[model samples]
Target chain A: MAEITLKSLAHSYSKNPAEPQDYAIREMNHVWHQGGAYALLGPSGCGKSTMLNIISGLLEPSNGEVLFDGKVVNSLPPEERNIAQVFQFPVIYDTMTVYDNLAFPLRNMKTPEARVHERVMEVADVLELTSQLKRKAKNLSADEKQKVSMGRGLVRDDVSAILFDEPLTVIDPQLKWKLRRKLKEIHHRFRITMVYVTHDQLEASTFADMIAVMYEGQVVQFGTPRELFETPNHTFVGYFIGSPGMNFLDVTVRDGKVFSGEAQLLVDNRVHDGIARATSDNVKLGIRPEFIEVHQEPVEDGMEVKVEHAQDLGTYSIVYASLGGISLKARVEEDQITPVDKAWLRFPSEKIGLYVDDYRVELPHE
Target chain B: MNKVYNNRAWWLILPMLLLVAFSAIIPLMTVVNYSVQDVFDAHTRFFTGTEWFVKMLNDPMLQGALLRQFAFSLTILAIEVPLGIGIALLMPKRGWQASVVLILVTMPLLIPWNVVGSIWQLFTRGDIGLMGWSLRELGYGYNITASPVDAWATIILMDVWHWTPLIALLCYSGLRSIPDAYYQAARIDRASKWSVFRYIQLPKLTNVLVIGVLLRFMHSFMIYAEPFVLTGGGPGSSTTFLSQSLTTMAIGQQDLGPSAAFSLIYFLIILLVTWVFYTAIMNMQKDDNKGA
Candidate 1:
């Protein structure tokens, strides 16, 4: 296994890219540590797949280098790079049996038949494809086919990394979880440097120890699931990580107070000082819906909001409220009283994130 | 829910039945009528039973032509299928070059059968044609009208030139339909170029190749125009295929009784051989352990 490093790597499909908009992957440097289970997470068309392809050596970056274990491997082709990739759709040789499909990569390397058989049996056992070994790969179900494809990657002992590009997309919902658990089990057992590319946050968070959140061709934040939820480094990360996302409101700092629209927002002096020294006028206050406390009765320093509606979602309820003409969502536990029509929302200072130009700003105190 | 048994719904198929009868059955019946009878005129006819059929089947000349037809069909198929696949492999996958190559490759298929024969006729003329004159100049005695071997070789080459494009186009479209991910996965698997073609491309092209082989077989089996135009069934009828022989007997000599019998035999041979080919290819596709 090898640590993959992207050093100032960038890519553009255009022959001559004049502006940053032309880039599919904007210039960035990132490192995936050796034997790390990492996920490149983003929405559709966010360049996560492009980054994965670059790391796998399927794509050559237009600028900068891709280093594997401190060696520049930009000139190497995918086959020479010793990497395996599972595509979005399962790609199996239709005529080959599951045994042959798993043995394909090993056979290509001219591995002896005895060892090939041993490896094939081992991988098939892990994928629970032992019974299917004699059957043609094309006859298997979609999830089984995906497992065979993954088994093809795992059979080769020399492979330094395995890149998955949304491999669970075609699987049935019930089997997706099983296959995901199978992948986790495999990762724990083998410890090959695995990079899973996915648009689903839950899949990424569950499968990856660290997720690199991509936004508009750039990796905005790389952190653990808890870290991303607690302190998102970028506004896009905050908005993308949690369900119903983080609530954002445009605010301005006047003297030592913060006001969103015409209504004054209660903020600690640390936030007020950070906003006061902000270089840009594009300032936003961000807070997760789960962190916001909703009260039916007005409490001290609580901002009054017009509760438009509340959705009772079994375990918890989401309060959709408007404060000073800005929409906000607050999550309330099922045991708590549901707020309706009008409610008071409290934003704890520790949970509040100040943003300037779509980037999180650190308050002076912490 | 109770099942509705509608007897009247069967009448809705009458139009298709009438169409099939008019298009196929009636014409076949006319041929059968002529085959079993000595029709002196439209009105005056004598029942011949299987006399014409026995005579036609036992004829030495007809037997020779049948054997020659099988050889020709098999030979052309063997040449065209692999050559077509190779051309498809070399073809550009996309861009303006792909369009240009496609149009160029399709040019031969668009020419009429007679026109293709005429083109080859002029092309292989011993005195003036490019190929014939070049062979002559290069000290090779290449006379299609004199030597049977030259005539047979020339006919095979002409057929290959005229029809390999159909197979190539079919295989090209089949190749294009395969997604790019397969290639990427193959690369990641460290598969050799030949391994990729053998495992990925050839298996995917099986469906189209089946169609291509069957079409080429049927077309080549009934081929009359091209060889007839170029060689005229000589070098002593060396290149005389079944269709040319049938045309000579039925139209030129006007042997109505025996020719009609031969026509039926010809139709059955094509039907039987095509059925065998189709069944064999389809059987190859089924799972080995599962007998169908």
Candidate 2:
């Protein structure tokens, strides 16, 4: 395993790279520690996959350097970089047997025949592909094909890192869970620097220890999955990293509390009013769906919202509600049978976030 | 009634069946008639009982033509298939550029076979044609009309130029159908360029290459026009192939009985050879699929 550092690495498909806005991936700096299971998480077109491709040497940055093990690999091809990548779809050699497909890379590298067979059988056993070893790959199902794709990547232990770009996209729902569990086990056993790229919050959270939240060509925040879920550093992150997503309500901050126009709420005394000094008076309050407690009565000093629709999804019910002429959503426990029209909403103050123009506010002191 | 009729759909095929019978059965009957009889005039014929077939069986011209046909087919196949695949491998994979390149490659296939022959005929002449002049300038004694080697090379070159595009286009289509994910998988496997081509690209191209081999083989075996125009069976009959021999028997010499007998033999050769090729390719494909 090896540590990868991206130093001011920027890229733009267009020549001249005329402006900061011209970059497909903007200037960024981060060191992915050795043996760390990290994820590049973002919406489509956010340059998360672009960054992964760059790290793998499939693409070169227009500027700066990508240092793997403290040596710049900007000029190296993906093979020279000694990294394995699993794509969104299974890419197997359909003309070869499944065993041969897994054995191909090792054979190409001229590994001893005995070792090649042993390594292939070992990985196949791990993936439960031993039964299909002699079977022609053309007749295998799609999920099986993807396992071969993965097995080919995992076969080479000399590779410093293994990267995956939404490798579960084509898997059947039942198989996807099993594969994810298998991948997590493999990562733990191998301790390779695995960088997984996905836009799914649940998959990212469950698979990756560190989730790097990306927005518009920038690494907005990189932290553990739980940290991202609990304290999202950006408005986009808060909204993106949840199933029903976070609810955002435009509010005005006054005194030591934030007001949702006459419905006042209090929070922990942190994030110095330096947030208010940011030149924008328009502030938005962000809260996870699970954090907002819904009640039947006026509930004395809680915010109010009109419930539009409630979706009962077995384990939990998500309520689509509106407040102050803006739509908001709240995910509550399945036990809460919320009525339509009127409901008392309590935004658990300590868990709430404030963003001015999509930028999150950081508390000055605890 | 419609559902019941679906089970008896051969009723809908009666006219087509009659059409096929009239075209195929009538000609076959006439050929058989000519093959076994002696004909002095269109209306006056006598049963000769395999007399022409016996004579055709021993004909030196038929033997030479068959040999020439095989040589021409093998030579053209060897030249065209690899050339076509190479060009395809080098062609761009996407965008308007790929379309433009496709059109350029398709241009040669669009040229009429007769026109292709005529064009090569003019282009291989001694005095003014660029090929002859260029070869002479380069100090090679080259004259396609008079030399068998020159004739053979010109025929091979002409066939390659005309038919290589077909193979390349088929290969290009096969290449394009490959998903990007496969390449990604190869990349992650840290596969080398040669390994990727050997294991991935070549295997993917096998089906298209088989199609190309069959097509080019059939077309080259029956080739008459280009070499006919360029060499005209001169230089003591070096460029003469089966079609020319068949035409010489039926039309030029007007030996109807002998021609009819020879035609059946020629048809059998092509049918047998094509069957062999088809069966061999299918067997290989099946084995590969099972092993894969």
Candidate 3:
């Protein structure tokens, strides 16, 4: 296994790119540590696949170096780099049996047939494909075909890493779960550096120890699932990660106090100072819906708002409310009294995030 | 529950039956009628009872033409399939060059069959043709009218030139339909170029190749216009194929009964061979399924 590093890597499909928008992947530096499970997560056209292709040596970057184990492998082809990639759709040799499909990479390396058999059997056993060894790959189901493609990678022992480009896309939802579990098992057993590229947050969170969330051809944040949820570095991350996402209200600083129109927000002194020091006019207050407290009765220090509606989601209810024309959502527990047409809302100081120019501003620690 | 039958639905198929009869069955029945009887005139006829079929089948001249027809069809198929695939492989994948090459490759196929024959005939004229004059200048006697080997070679080369483009176009379309992901996967697998073709490309091309092969086989088996215009079955009938022989018997010599019988045999041979090819390919797929 090897640590794969992208050093200021950038790529543009155009012959002469004149603007940052032309680049599929903007200049950035990132690393997948040796034997680490990482996911490159983003929305469609967000350069996640482009970054994966650059790492696999399938597409040469227009600029910067891809270093493997501290050695620059910028000029090496995918085969020479000893990297395996499973594409979005399953790609297997239609004429070959599953056994032969698994043995293909080994055979290409001129590995001995005896060892090839051993490796194929081992991978097949792990994938629960032992009974399908003799069957033609083309005759198998979609998920099985995907497994065979993954097996083609697992059969080779010399591969430094296995890259997956949404390899479970063609699979059914139930099979997607099983195959994901199987992949997790493989990563744990083989300890190979695996980088999965997907547009799904749950897939990334479940499959990767660390997720590099990309936005507009740039990696906006790289952190653990919990860290991304609790402390998103960019506004896009905050809006894109959690269900219903984080609620934000455009605010302005006046005398070291944050105001959403005419009413002043009662926030911590650190947030007040952070807003006072912010130079941009794009200052906003962000808070997760889950952390917002909603009470049917007005209390001291609580902001009164018009409750639009509440959606019962079994264990918890999401109350959609409006405060002086600004809309917000708050997740209230089922045991709590449901809010009526009006309710009191409170933004917990510890859970509140202050944003300036669409980026979270770190508040001074107490 | 009891099922009910609708007899009125039978009337719904009358139009299709009439269309089929007018387009196919009526014409085929005329040939069958002629084959089964010796028609001296429209009103006067005698029952032949397979007598003409026996005579036509035993005719040595017809037998020689039949053998030559199979040899020509098999030879041209063997040459065209591989050459077409090779051309497709060497073709540019995109850009203006790909369009230019496609236009150039399709030029021969666009020409009328008789026009192709006339073009080759002038192209190989001993007195003034480029190939024939060049061979004569080099002190080599390359006369299609005088030598059977030269005549056969010229006809085979002409057929290959005229038809290899169809196969190439089919194979090219087939190759284009395969996604880039297969190639990327093969590259990651470290597969050699030959292995890529053998495992990925050839398997994907099988469907198109089947269509190309069957079309070329049927077209070549019914060869008439080119050889008819160029050689007229000369050089002691060395390049005479079954269609030309049937044409000579039916239209030239006016042996309607025997020619009709020969036509039936010719039709059956093509149908039988095509069936065999189709079944062989389908059975191969069935075996793969059984293995699964």
Docking class of 1: medium
lDDT for model 2, please. Answer: 0.84
Question: Which residues of candidate 3, in runs, are more than 4 Å off?
Answer: A262-264, B1-7, B288-292
True contacts kept of each: 0.72, 0.62, 0.79
Among residues 3 or more apart in sequence or in different chains, the pairs in candidate 2 whose N, CA or C atoms overlap within 3 Å are A136-B292, A137-B292, A271-A363
The iRMS of the candidates, in order, is: 2.9, 3.2, 1.9
Model 2, B76-119: lDDT tens digits are 88888778888999999889998899999999999988899888
Write one digit per residue (lDDT tens) for candidate 1, span A288-344. Answer: 999998998998879999999888899999999998888999999989999879999
Off by over 4 Å in 2: A253-278, A363-366, B1-6, B14-55, B92-107, B137-139, B180-190, B287-292
Which residue runs does candidate 1 get wrong by more than 4 Å? B290-292
Top candidate on DockQ is 3
* Residue clash pairs of candidate 3: none
Query: Deviation in angstroms for A134 in model 2?
Result: 2.5
Residue B105: error of model 3 in Å? 0.8
The candidate with the higher lDDT, 1 or 2, is 1
> For candidate 1, what is the total of clashing residue pairs?
0
The residue-level lDDT of candidate 2 at A119 comes to 94
